[model samples]
Target: MHKRMAMLAFIILVVAWGIPSAKAACSTPVVNASFGSVTSFAVNSTASTSSGSLSVNCGSSLATIFNTDTISVRLTASTFASGTQAIMKKVGDSSGDNIPITVCLSVQNCGSPMTIGAPATTFNSTQLSIFLLTGGKNFTIPLFFSTQPGQTVAAGTYTTTLSFLTNWDICTGLGVGIGGIQICVIDQNGSATLSLTVTLEVTNDCTTILAPAVNFGTAPLLSSFSSVVQTISVTCTKGSVYTVGLNDGIHAVNGVRNMASGSNLIRYDIYQSTTNNRWGSSIASQRWSSTNATSVSTNQLIRNYNYTATLLSGQTTPVEGNYSDTITVDLSF
Candidate 1:
């Protein structure tokens, strides 16, 4: 009986020693945040908004204990040009300039001037919580950014790298970084950068609206020196210098421009002023040149040039028919 009792006690001790501990080993949470390329922000834009998504992945160990975990992301302020959080030209630029822009996690939270690299306090502000499932959880975070009104920058493809930091809770009812909480930074993805690139594109643009054709209506074949005044309207970037040139008509001989009717030709000439100086196709002999300064609005600048065309008097009288000519107008900036 004594031997049996001793064996039973040994068996109980072995069974107790083989049992696993109640406290399970915790695995570090895995996190990955990503966003697509933002849409181009236009220069001189009053207001614009762009959106993207962030993805977060949690490990099985962390998911087993907690059904939900909190995460906080912070955007580090840009260091380009006076520490402004703006985009800069990536190539072919001598001046290292930045385009001013405003970024936010949501439209309502914009323009608050929150410090970069600072920790987000509340989920409504910049922090969000993810709900874990049986195996694990994949969370999607939405991001939004807006640009300041009346912002103008240089013309180029601007780019900037935005840095983000993520912090999450490891255990149930435990706040972030409280009582051995875990934090996974953007660079924790093993050589995979956790960053989003913000891009803005600025282009120098101009639009030209030509006036209706000048009609020297229904004149007799013997009519001498018929003339008409025509105008050309142009709108270009503010402070942009541009020139307008009118090419010689289809019927021309050795730079002498003319108009035509079927096989018949009528000699004519285009002049920049009433003084009758001929307007040529070359830039040096352009009909009009000016620096655009007339701002019709914040986004538009307008300029007008007047030209006169005359029918030469020495042409022999020809058969009466509809006469017309097409001239190619060239605008150079």
Candidate 2:
């Protein structure tokens, strides 16, 4: 009978041990887009014309060399969209200093890889022909080159480039815009334009921190005690040390008191001194430092310190009155 009972208990324990446990849920997010490999569409012309009731009044010298005049490309990625898409357009010859040029772009339904080119007289290719210089918004885009005040484009080549990433799926498309350029001299015109046939991916999500200011209250001290305790409290970042000291605020508490001294007596007996009197002339008088107090920190309600007061031997027992002193507290990071 005993052996049968033991076997039954063992069977119950085995069944309990075989029971399955519940699983915990995970919190990872699903990200499914790449925006790092996109490039800006190409700018065909050196000067772009705005559609928004704007005009360009190039002098006779610039007008004559409109085709061969030195032009540069520039780009700015300020336009942000919802979801995960961002556009950054770069123009060729972006470093041409002091000279202004116009730029334009067009978007089309690309089949696979994307391609952009100069304005065509007629629609011959499968891609749509977007006229950047013909018309549209009156916004003016400016491009320039760095040069000595009066020196012109010193008979050389110049260019600029721009690129952007799609916030959603990696789609080959052109960012629309009417580019402009700036100029200080007009000698020989040599320009550079960018090609928008390549694709790139991009990323733009990040994190940051925030901090608040510290506020303080008026501090008070005991007026009669030379060795008084000043309390201070502050809030700060975790695992960081905050140091506070006196001398930063006004001192209000001051004064001193006399202490009596005595010794032990017979068995189970306690002898004390209760004698009271004015400042005496033997030994020393109760004295204290007039300036520069001390500071300390701990996990307690109050901190105490011993200060030497001008002690007068003839002075009798300390007067039976409340004595206090005041000090300042300074807080720092």
Candidate 3:
């Protein structure tokens, strides 16, 4: 009976000694990640993305102890200055213009709603587990960005810094604070940083649609002067300053514009407004200037201008048939 009791005590000691008594120590690893600049952002850009890589070395010792690990990555929200999502804009610009941006591990990463700068906005693989093998692991995450169509913003090179945070846990079945196994928490001790740059260009553009011809049809010769109204439609980029001018008609002499029928010419003048102020070559006084300041969520803005043309009272009508002249419309922005 004494020998049996001693053998049982020895067996208990062996079993207790076989189990680990301390938590495994892991060396902090350096994460090597980088991405290039994205240059496709425009005023009409819908969405754009830049591809990058994330890789880290866990070392053989740490991988052996923690065979499997679950990892999630978070980005610092303060880096983005606009909205709930990440944004970019011209460096050193005082203007409050910005372009909305976001980051994702895959299409699945974008599915989860995340607020900028919050740790809850993390990216991880839901379908698969990340294992810390002998060699380590690498991942691919893309930065997604977008701008509204016809968005009016300052044009320049925009830059921002992206800081990464990583959280990890061991896949061991053992509970924390039991049997010498402690809670697993992997902090971003040596995460990598990427300097992201985006560029935008603002261009001035305009489209002009001319109205139908002003027909002073069948006016009685040597009768009272005839008058007609004409119009032009101009669409331009928002916030663009522009000027509109009407050149001398094809038949002109010493600034006396005329409509001709064969060899006979009838004098006429174009007024800028109903007030009868002449529309001429000078941009300061005789031309029309306006600002495309109408705020629109989408599409370019249109501005219309109307002018009146009148035949001079002193015109002596001679042989007449179909009388016409082409006046060129000029727009400068």
Candidate 4:
């Protein structure tokens, strides 16, 4: 009686090994499409980028009975998406400040991306794998992203959320008779939504500076030389406080700026205000400041600094030749 009971139990275990398991389910996504701390000028000058992956996993159900599974992720705009492209806006800002962006699978050129709320585009090609090896076909879709250029936005964090759809085919190998192995046990429509949080950061800074050329044109004598005024235009991040400094000219002697003509020096000075004080490269020398006490509210706030270059009266007249000197301009924040 004991031998018969052991044989019956062994037969039951063999039958259970051949039976199919339950259907497969994928893991929920936690993704972020983040471009950390990008300057406003960087986003405007070129594409700012961030990336995250979308993954798929089917259950391990008897590799002997299954060949390999194929998968294709389709990127479609979600329910909350409105435009034909993804747009990020400043968090908690209701003034409608937005930055348009795009996502791509290939890094060659993000030229063509799927529309935000239109037909679906395949995120990746058919992912092929052997069912027995590499359990659940461990794979991750390579997502590339870029923000559209030419945006002059305020300094802060910008954010948006995008949606996607994924489709997969879980196949089974049934027979080794006709054409080797046959495909069977298709999925009963597998799909999932991915909410991709896109974020960007803009820091307060001075972006651009347009220095002026002070042309003290053609003065035959020292006393006849007139003061020349020129403007320095500066573009900075909105609300950022900054200062501009000008170094003494390349040709100088005893703290006095000089224009050199073949070692013949002519004295001159550059002042922030008309005869107030010479503009030198130091905070103590009183660099031009962007703000007094209030924030600059405009985007790419351009401030103009007018300076006067006067030929000093004490210097004797030099020979008849062209004299020029170069001064270095710097920005501090």
Highest-TM-score candidate: 4
How much does candidate 3 score in TM-score?
0.58
Each prediction's whole-model lDDT (CA): 0.54, 0.22, 0.54, 0.67
Candidate 2, residues 1-333, lDDT tens digits: the string is 888767755664564355322111211111111122211111111221221111121212212111222112222222221122222222342323222222232212222211122222111112211211333211112211111122122111222222221111110111111123322222222222222221122111111111121111122321222322222233222122333333311212122222222221111100111223211112122111112113222322122222222223333334343332223333333
lDDT of 1 by residue, 1-333 (tens): 888767755664564355434223323333322222322223455555565544555433321222334555566655343454554444556654445555565343555643465656334212343333445333455666555555434345665555656554433221122235432211112112246666655555565556678788876765743688877777665445667678887888777776788888888888775657676667475556655222244433566666788887777978888888888877776
Better of 1 and 2 by lDDT: 1
- What shift in Å separates residue 264 of candidate 3 from its native position after superposition? 2.0
The number of the candidate with the highest lDDT is 4
Better candidate number, 2 or 3, judged by TM-score: 3
Winner by TM-score between candidate 4 and candidate 2: 4
**Alpha-carbon TM-score of each model against the true structure:** 0.52, 0.18, 0.58, 0.65
C-alpha positional error of residue 307 in candidate 2 after TM-score superposition, expressed in Å? 17
Model with the higher lDDT, candidate 2 or 3? 3
Against the hidden true structure, what lDDT does model 3 obtain? 0.54
User: Per-residue lDDT tens digits of candidate 3, residues 102-203?
Assistant: 555434236653345566334443422342343433333344433334345533455455555655443322222323544322222233333444333445
Clashing pairs in 1: none
Error of 2 at 117 (Å): 24
Q: List candidate 2 stretches off by more than 4 Å.
A: 1-61, 64-231, 235-242, 247-317
Tell me the deviation in Å of residue 189 in model 3. Answer: 4.0
